[model samples]
Target: MSSDRLRMYLFSSMLAAVTAIFAQIEIPLPLVPISGQTLAVGIAATILGSRYGAFSMVIYMMLGVIGLPVFAGFAGGAHIVAGPTGGYIVGFIAAAFFTGLFLEKTAFTYKMAIIANLIGMLVTLTFGTIWLKILLDLSWPAALAAGVTPFLAVGVIKALLAAWIGIAVRERLKSSQMSFGKAA
Candidate 1:
């Protein structure tokens, strides 16, 4: 592989590793534990674009599937994918994909970025709620209450942070690319 390809692979690997590490650091809440992994996912998409962003998430998931202790609370294994949170776990990939799609189509303004981030998180919540309801056999209202309602505040905050970080990364990447061209 070319040096650039190697660099990209290394960077993607780093992002995946860091994402798993960040997933472990969580603040336990009344309903669910909150982690910075979502923020990392969003930023990864913005920085790495759709292909690499999704690839990183795929790698992360694959690691978990193979029984790596890379998930929250060091939990991992294929069985985890069948748990109540499995939908959300699957949502993470969709979140990154949609987030990257938005980022690619729009200018990286604060408002635009935040909107993209919100949309991304919404996609995640949609899948998460569905999986949660099925896994728990919850009524619609109960599922909303258990999966979505309580997470609103935290989700908003995480979205904002993701947007901010994504925008910053976007700028940095732009400048870095420009510099690389100049050097070339």
Candidate 2:
């Protein structure tokens, strides 16, 4: 493979690994455990842009679904996805995809990244909340209560941090001509 393609492949794989690692670091909550998954997603999207960022999440999902110990609490397999929080797991892909898409379409500014990551978080929250309601036969309020509301404050904070950190990291990488995840 060409050097650039090789770098992308390696970087994407590394991001996938990072996502898995972050998933394990969580604070147990009522329905869903707060985890570092989104932080990793933000970093991946900002650094790799949309396509590879989404691809990295896809890799992480596939690994988890295939019974690897990559999910929160080191749990994995298809069954994990069938549980209450499954939707959020699936939503990670959408989050990464949209976050990356936004970065790709606009200049890589912190403001733009924050907006993109927040939007991505919303996409994730929507999917998870809906799935939670259906899975538990909950009223909309209950579902929102269980899945979305609690996450809002932290989500925004994470989005901002991800944007700042991701952008800064990307800038450093670019200055060094070592942007492993930058699109060729």
Candidate 3:
């Protein structure tokens, strides 16, 4: 394999490890337990962009699927993916992807950044709530109760924070680029 490919692989593995660590920091709500994993997801996207961000989450999920203790409460394996939170886990990838996509398309101003993170939260909620309904065979109302509604407030706050951080990083990168140009 090429050096670049090897580097990417190593980076992705590190992303997975970090994501798993973030996943463990949780506040168990009655419906969908709140976790810091989403923050990691946003950071991964903001730092790595869409492709690598998605790739990293894929690695994270694969590790969990292979029985690595890389999930909330140190849980992993098939049961985790097939359980109530499976959809949320899947949502993580989608959310990250959208966050990166939005940032790539628009200038990373504060408003745009907020919009991007909001998109990420919506991505998670939509996919997660749909899956939750199907997996549990619940009506729309019940499914929403089980999945989306309960987590709205916290999700918004998390999205806002992620958006702020993402924008800040982009701004810093831009400033650094300008400095390098001037130095050259």
- Name the top TM-score candidate: 2
Off by over 4 Å in 1: 1-5, 29-32, 178-184
Worst 10 residues of 2 by lDDT: 175-184
Q: Which ten residues in a row have the lowest lDDT in candidate 3?
A: 175-184
Best by lDDT: 2
**Model 2 over residues 82-162: C-alpha lDDT tens digits?**
998799988988888899888778878999999999998998999899999999999999999999988899899889988
TM-score of 1: 0.88
Q: Candidate 3 residues 1-184, lDDT tens each?
A: 6665565566557777888998999989765688878877776676556666777899998899999999888889988888888998898899888887887787556777678878888898888889889998989999998788877898888888877776676568567652211111
Model 3 Cα shift for residue 52 (angstroms): 1.0
Which RMSD does model 3 reach against the true structure?
Answer: 4.4
Q: Which lDDT tens digits does candidate 1 get at residues 1-184?
A: 6666666566668778978988898877544467777777877776666666777788888899899988777889988878876787788888878877786677666787788788888987898889888888989998888788877888899889888887786678677762211111
Which residue pairs show collisions in model 2?
none
Against the true structure, what is each candidate's TM-score? 0.88, 0.93, 0.85
Better model by TM-score: candidate 2 vs candidate 3: 2
Q: Please tell me which model should have the higher TM-score, number 1 or number 2.
A: 2
Q: Determine the C-alpha RMSD for candidate 2 after optimal superposition of all C-alphas.
A: 1.7
